[model samples]
Target: MPEADSSTTPAIVLDGVSKAFGANVVLDEVSLTVRQRSIMVMLGPSGTGKSVLLRCLVGLLRPDKGRVMVFGEDVASLDAGVAKDRRQLFRIRRRFGMLFQDGALFDDMTVGENVAFPMRMHTSMSAAEIRASVDDKLRRVGLPKATSKFPSELSGGMRKRVAFARAIALEPDIVLCDEPSSGLDPVMAATLDELILELHKTLGMTFVVITHDTAEARTIADTIGLLSRGKLVTYGPTDEVLRSNHPALRQFFARSTEGPIQVL
Candidate 1:
């Protein structure tokens, strides 16, 4: 509900971000900045810590080293209660939304209730107001009539759309999508991508998408980061990364086997 500056103050800043689970390091001294209102795609093979980085960015996971700043506040050091209070980071987080890979909808609740879940938990809206908001969100996602169905009743794509509706219910400034196109076919994937771009242009919101689909990445990302072995191997504009001669990036774009990525 807050107005994001959409300036160059970095929507998210990870300085020397690292994480280790005992002896295995998931992210190693990775540093990156996501500019406001830009679509940043984090691409890498499986197990390269893409999801880990995303969780850290959203404060779901804390890194062992360096700092994670959201809207200029250090989230890694903020206490649990303080982090959720009326602080800059909390307000900034309210400006962002997230869509998980599985849609993550509650099986017991109807689609409308699912979309209204956040509003119910966070707001003091009356029952009628919540219903109105839920209806609006469903219509926004092109699923005005799918409100009564449960998650299992809808198709995978429909469930995803419901999840998306829930994510933007609060009109977040940014949307973090983890493998948004993972379970959809080409047609459905493209439709979802179109929805993303449409929302970005219409709402003036930033997007941080994590996906390994090159086609989708090329289609949606203004900036791309190629991550490998817990590090950002390459980062730049989509065209620049595609035109680059770096072996890792080149082989990745070409779908080659002999590159920095190990096929284990």
Candidate 2:
């Protein structure tokens, strides 16, 4: 057989995925593909399954029914409790990095320490190597002089940039940002969007961002998805999906109260 082509394989594929907690369905047969080296923005209202989908991708949760494929492996089938599966899952998780909604940085550590934490934990690189890499990551996020500053010393936007630097410390193939623009003003959010675009353009990694911010989605996503009431309402090329006559899409973009999306 000819060599497998990496270009044709998507970075992520969620096929007929469903999840529930008791009677509360969080994801209902949601299916989507995230291409490599592209930014995918998932838009949804609060309580929708956007965050849960991220958890499923990282194996923090498993789907009730369906496949969650990351780089061709079905992550939904892995069980952390089993030794063999755990090993495989660990390897899979290493390919992914996440930026939490709250910019989950350690309050006690300096920015450099925070960025180097992942490398220290998972990599065999030398201390000098880690330090150099930390500086480079910080520079990439536009915080070159913040290595010595504590999280408390920085503004919310700066903190988020530090968190993003940490997320990409390992240079993972895919980075997941959960509400990256949360807790920031519109200008700061737009700055974050620019950082995302710059990083994607320079480093060439796949990005999956889950947010309710349509503006951020429009700025960063080449592919867009909308999740509501545990179902994927619309997903496709950004221009195509935005232009389509989908009620949820319209309601979301228009910021209208009357639509299929119920306010909860």
Candidate 3:
């Protein structure tokens, strides 16, 4: 057990953000703020722009309207000219790590290579230093031995753990995860949730998780945001959001087909 930090400024903020692709509108006036070192769950059905919102938070996707501030800096305000300097890009990218769905590991790279790739690209560390960092992060994710294994050879859960290890290798202040529990069994998903909670306690990192797993969110989130049709339908503490009786909230909780959500 270690000393835990109970206070920090908001890590990420969005105000009146909206995005569209051709005829399809993704995010609609989405406004939210994630506190530092807290796990905020973004709950929404598929195609509801959860991933789009996560991308915008990291400055990966520029919104058509509104602002995205990371660590109090308006990331959306940084001009494209900022990336002209490799050092600037490296510094900016170091503040956050993103773990995408399906692990997103390169099939051709070994797990160790995948984990150390960022270090190699961004830092001037020697081989020994990179190895040590990769090993330590993999150990944190409970996958120290799987480093020699290729992504194709590892189980889905193991791949995810490796991905998590890689994401945190930089000691990023903020972590964004998209559908972390996807393709896992109930028990495995719960285990991953516990791992995430453990990391939150140990690392003191801000986490924004975009997941449709209500059960998982209930277990790990300090607050939850529910998205529907590109709009934030509900946002509050975990218990409050989950227990609410709003029609849309009820439909989400029931996971019903007759609710406000419709699939094409």
Candidate 4:
């Protein structure tokens, strides 16, 4: 079969994806499409398989059923245990840059070094080039003055900004942000949303942002998907999903506990 044009192909496709840890089901036949060069926001209450979905896309976790397609490649079919397959998986993974929930920055490394970490590990760029790129990325994140400081010397928001700078150091095709607004105050979180928007426009990378904050989703998402107990209940354009009267969707936005989504 002739392959679809790369420009038109979706960045990610999950068909009937399901994951289970023994008897507990995390993802139940969940399927969705993330169009290329778009920002997708995944919203749900705590413990709704949002984080697991990101891991599945990167091959950190495998699904028991269904296919996970990334840019026309079926990642679910590749076995990391095999030498050749592992190589292929590595190539697929190189297309991704992940921002962890806790802003996992090395405490001892200087801000510039932390941003340069991925480039040093993955690419053969010369030291001068890495240093320049690090400076540029820090400037983009509004943290140019903190280059010599350690993570311990920075505030929580500044540390996260440095981590964001590192996540884009490789210029990956897809960037996955796990709870980008998790621990910050509302102002800081909103500031990060603006940064995400700016990076998306300038970098042209597909972004899948997992966030529980409704305001964050509304502020940044081109498309929105609501996941409940591993099932995708409502998904569409950001405006459409926001207008939806579906109980689960409404309950989530209204901050209500009594609805189709039960509180444990």
Most lDDT-accurate candidate: 2
Off by over 4 Å in 4: 1-5
CA lDDT, every model vs. true structure: 0.84, 0.91, 0.82, 0.90
Which model is ahead, 1 or 2, in terms of lDDT? 2
> What is the alpha-carbon RMSD of candidate 1 to the true structure?
2.6
User: What are the TM-scores, per candidate, against the unseen true structure?
Assistant: 0.90, 0.95, 0.90, 0.95
lDDT of 2 by residue, 1-264 (tens): 322227778899999999999999999999989999999999889999888999999999999999999988899999999999999999999999999888889999999999999999999999999999999988877789999999999998899989999999999899999998887788878877888888788888899998888888888899999888998999999999988969998999889999999998
Per-residue alpha-carbon lDDT of candidate 3 for residues 87-186, written as tens digits (9 for 90 to 100): 4434556888889876799889999999999889778999999999998988877777988899999888888878888888787888888988887788
Q: Whose TM-score is higher: candidate 2's or candidate 3's?
A: 2
Write candidate 1's Cα lDDT for 131-154 as tens digits. Answer: 998998788777889989999999
Q: Worst lDDT window (10 residues) for model 2? A: 1-10
Colliding residue pairs in candidate 3? none
- What stretches of model 1 exceed 4 Å from their correct place? 1-6, 81-92, 126-129
Pairs with backbone N, CA or C atoms under 3 Å apart (clashes), candidate 2: none
Candidate 4 lDDT at 147 equals 90
Candidate 3 weakest lDDT stretch, 10 residues: 1-10
* Candidate 2: regions farther than 4 A off: 1-5
